[model samples]
Target: MPQLQEPKLIAGNANMPLANAIARRMSMHRGKQVGLVDARVERFNDGEIFVEVFENVRGEDMFILQSTSNPANDNLMELLIMADALRRSSAARVTAVLPYFGYARQDRRTKARTPITAKLVANMLVGTGIERVLTMDLHAAQIQGFFDIPVDNLYASPIFALDIQTTFKKRMDELAIVSPDVGGVARARELAKRINSPLAIVDKRREKPGEIAEMTVIGNVKDKTCLIVDDICDTAGTLCKAAEVLIENGAKEVHSYITHGVLSGPAVERVTNSVMKSLVVTDSIAPTDAVKKAKNIRIVPTAPVFAQAILNIWSGTSVSSLFEADTLSPIYDGTYAAE
Candidate 1:
């Protein structure tokens, strides 16, 4: 790998903690001091977004870290404006690093007059002059195709598998990984295979956004510890209902592992009162104060993965190597045993 100019990291108001953690990992990996580029992202009294890049970015590889979470529209606008500002400032390349891509659930339309907002968001980013995109665990993998530019969609399965092994240890064989809906069966099945656990699916139908009809457990879960896996946990309606039904069907205990925790509305309340034993989520989107205060919630840092990916992209190396669920190498100090 050849050395290009040092890449510049810029974070939006979306997830500063994850961005800072990523920067720390990058500095450690490079064996050199690395820090975020100075930038200001703010809003006016009328709630208009503003973005300003303090340092010169001319010919520098710029990575803008932003997750369109709670205030999806606001954070999204911030990212777009930042990318536009970077291009106008003469950046060599602008990579939008979206750990949790919002509007992804609406990748397609089921009705005649619905909008494909995910594609719209992609078009907006590309039109704003973003050269590339780096996101993780999109609600739909096909969303990557929506962008004309190169898109890297990272996975959180390896991270969850490592933590599951560490947490359950000898009890993994007594576990069953479940998908809350048929759509997530592939993700759950992959994790189940990694841990050698039985796979189950919660057959569910969505009545409307943020709501689910009665769900049925597809596989045997009687007396087995159940682990429901999915990409996003928003509103908690589906997860809470799935956990309740899984327990009603005789599961010993219900645990959840998800990539993005967009715990909106009464999500925390629902999880706290639900039958789920615990909910583990990655720090793709920053956790709210309520999420941190919840007793049944755990957070796993995802910085090492993103940091390594960014480094690989900057060095023109193979990013696919990071996807393997083997022992994480020198990059992560073998801290993450992917299996």
Candidate 2:
């Protein structure tokens, strides 16, 4: 077992709900072991971030929890500065545990003179002296290659599967799993295989960046309940459009399962007007005002899953087993496996 004995967990201002949830799963409160001095993140006269970890972290295995979500640049700087602070404090190893790796979708260029922001983010983390990256459900698997150090890309599909199995147990016979677009076909296929249900795909044609035309459904969905699965839902364009198509194709009911709910700019309104029965999202990105007020939106916590992975990693066990969707009864059942 790796036994990161005396491992230290620190958190920043971003996504405190998720940080506290993970800490609870670890059976500890935040800042119980060491001095978590007041973090004063304020801008200077010219607008530059300043941070200092008031506690000693010398020779400790430190994990800093911060999500680069809304206010992406500020949160990102906080993570970078936290890592730098730990490194300067002589920590043995510093790991940036980002539940949501922002800008991950910009892994490649769609046009000339474009920047791969994902790689740039990785370079920034490397420059901050971070030794490892622990994140969940990246937009692209190859983003792991963007980092020079060990990057553990975790999946939330298994956790979601448990939820769906219980929620729709009675309707399993008439259920259908759907991918919002061609890019998410693999992810949707994996989830479908786990639930032992049929898979479907929506092929969308984009006349431009903002305008998406949902072309057709590649699988049978008539008289069946549809579950559209995707890694993230940013503008809610693809998800909403696909659900509309499914309903138009005689789908009895439509539901969505998206990992990261980066619901920005009128997303809640779009979902409210869409045909989806409900939108299930994780705590990857903190919910906004509209998302919280939206009647059809539901939140599924990923704390237990991330905590278990951390425990497994600390105990020197294989996290690969977490990928299989069959053993995920705890998520929807409201009970968890501690073994």
Candidate 3:
């Protein structure tokens, strides 16, 4: 069998820390010689994006790591320009690595005459000559269908399950996994099953964007520690409300494990005053200064998972296998309950 060529990991300005971390992991996995591709991605005075790859990526696979987070448009445009640059430079394949795929919530039109921006974003990428896409915890699974190229949606559930097991080890039996909304029950149930805990749902009605009309806990949480799970926490209104409802229903403590901390607007303040004890989010999107200053917020690095997924894809291995709790446990395994 021919040896697989090492992919050149490229970083965009969106999330430098995460990009560097993933590059390091890739190097470790492929031996010392493999490293990140030296590149330049910046903007002109008029805010025009410019990209240049210093090293030859000709006929080599290139993975561009970027998160369309805050200043979403600029970051997203930067990714498109970078991919175009690589494609024009003759790179064999360009896989976009979006940890927090922004505009994902706008996958569908909730109102009449509204455009499906998610499909537009997918179209933009395909138009840029990109070959594949790798992302984590997409807001809607159907968004993958929007792309003509192959798309791999990674999950943070395994990581969250491991953390939950370690944090609530002795109290596993009294722990409940919660979905802040009906749509997220599957994600919550998967995590709950992994730790052998019961599942709960937060039934909420939204009167308008960013406001919750009514909130209710659908399962018994009295005397139990609840872990609210979701993909995104933009504005954090739903999260805070769910935590409050859980507390009011007698949950001993409430915590959250969200994939993307799009903690925009008054999210920090809301979380600070809420009944939730802590908010754990993956480093899919770089946290804002406010998010960094929040006492209750904790960040879990996601580079390791992305690094492994990149390697697996390049090696023709199953990316879904990474979600099997037992398979990825060696990285951060801990006994969460007495067997």
Candidate 4:
């Protein structure tokens, strides 16, 4: 571990539950160590965001736990201000640990003259004097390259993979990992390999944003249980539509595994009414009430994973192994009870 004289932990206004979880895992003296500022955001008559960090963080290694969840802009501005405050306060280092990096989808210019919003966000973080980044399952991996400072893109796959093994024990081999779109083929394939299963792909043409995607599944999903894997589940049109296509193609069962559950608009209703059996999401960003109460939804806790990463980072240990999801011990792996 890099022996710093005094290490500080700063919790941003976003995802306080998760931040507290990480703090508890660290065994830090709760409110005494990791402090929160009022950060009472207000919109002026003209609609603007203002923030203030009330805590003093001189010569401290500060880590700000925030997620760019809903109201992404507001939460993002809060994080930026927190980092700038820590930097200007004479803190030794500042690392922005975002469990969910919002606006990650706009990582590239799909069309001519389009802005790469993901890159823009990266610039904002680096410009604000963030020393490093520790985030999970960003919409695109290339978002890491956009940052001049080091960006550790963490993975939730190990937690999900282990959950899958226990959730469907004997039937895992009969599974065909399906990607909702060709872009997610790599993620689906990675999960499939962890469980030693085959992979399938769903090819689709986007009709419009927020509309059901008309997809033609590319692989043989007939007579096999299908799991559609992706990084994020927003609106969930693609997942629901993909499930329909797979079922129409003779899939025995359909499920969706997504890392971040940005279930905005009609996502919950769509998934509830779709042919999908269940939607699995991680507790990276806190779930909305609809998702929390949905019978067809299951959440895998990422608190332990985030906590472990924080400890490792603080101790100056390598964190690359944490990104490999399949190696983690499952909650139902016949051991939690013993503890």
Q: What is the lDDT of candidate 2?
A: 0.83
Where model 3 places Cα greater than 4 Å from the true spot, the runs are 332-339
lDDT (0 to 1) per candidate: 0.91, 0.83, 0.88, 0.79
| For every candidate, C-alpha RMSD to the true structure in Å | 1.5, 2.9, 1.8, 3.1
lDDT of 4 at 74: 84
How high is each candidate's TM-score? 0.96, 0.92, 0.96, 0.90
Candidate 2 lDDT at 86 equals 82
Candidate 2 residue lDDT tens string, 117-180 = 9999999999999998889999999999999998888888887777787788777889899998
Q: Per-residue lDDT of 156-275 in model 1, one digit per residue for the tens? A: 988888888878887877899999888888888888888889999999877786667678899999999999999999899899999999999999999999899998999999999999
lDDT per residue (tens digit) for residues 1-339 in model 4: 457544455666667778777766555422345434334544568866665556666777778888999979888998888788778888888889999999898988888999999989999999999989999987878889999998888877677677777787768778989988788877888888877888999888877766654678787999999988999988887788889889999999998889998899999999999999999998788887889899999888776777667656767887786755433463223422112
| lDDT of model 4, residue 112 | 100
Cα lDDT for residue 304, candidate 3:
74
Please give the ranking of all candidate structures by TM-score, highest first, separated by commas: 1, 3, 2, 4
Please give, for residues 1-339, the per-residue lDDT of candidate 3 as tens digits.
353567778888989989888888777777775567898888899999999889998898889999999899999999999999999999899999999999998988888999999999999999999899999999988999999999999989888887777777777788889999999999888888888889999999988887788998898999999999999998888898889889999999999999999888888999988889999999999888888889999998887789889988887789998887777765443332223
- In Å, residue 8's CA in model 3 sits off its true spot by 0.6
The worst-scoring run of ten residues by lDDT in candidate 3 lies at 330-339
- TM-score: which is higher, 1 or 4? 1
- Please state the error at residue 287 of candidate 4 in Å: 1.2
Candidate 2: give the clashing pairs: none
Q: Which stretches of candidate 4 lie over 4 Å from their true place?
A: 5-7, 28-50, 211-213, 325-327, 330-339
